[model samples]
Target: MINAKKLEEIAKQVSESLPPSVKQFAEDMEGKTKQILQSKLSQLDMVSREEFDVQTRVLMRTREKLVDLEQKVAALEASINQQQPESNE
Candidate 1:
């Protein structure tokens, strides 16, 4: 989700940019702008930096486990092959 404080700051900046004639409506405009910004941002698929980093760490751990499992399987196969008798026997 987008940060509410940042969204409010952006809305305030927009409101402050209006002409004197529209100054009376600045508060209302700020509220509307905040709603619009939040709605639009929610529609998009996004993740916070922290969330992304957590997922990255999970992927790294999973990859490491996969490599370890592969090596173990290879060793087991080699051992099984060694224990089997020759077909000519």
Candidate 2:
């Protein structure tokens, strides 16, 4: 989610851009702009930086476990193949 402070700063900038005649409504405009920004931002599909980092770590661990299992399976298959030839002789 976007930070509240950053949203407020954006709203202030927008309100300040209005003509002098609208300056009387600057406060109102600022509040409305902030609400609109928050509403639109919330509608987007997004994740925080921390959440993204945590998911990346989880994926790395899962890949490591997968690789270890593959190596163990290959070793077991090789051992079985060797035993099969000896048993047939």
Candidate 1 overall lDDT versus native: 0.94
Candidate 1, 1-89: lDDT as tens digits: 89999999999998878897788676689999999999999999999999999999999999999999999999999999999986884
Off by over 4 Å in 1: 1-38
TM-scores for all predictions: 0.55, 0.54
lDDT of 2 by residue, 5-53 (tens): 9999999998878898788676689999999999999999999999999
The TM-score that candidate 1 achieves is 0.55
Q: Which regions of candidate 2 fall more than 4 Å away from where they truly are? A: 1-19, 22-35, 86-89
Give the number of the best model, judged by lDDT: 1
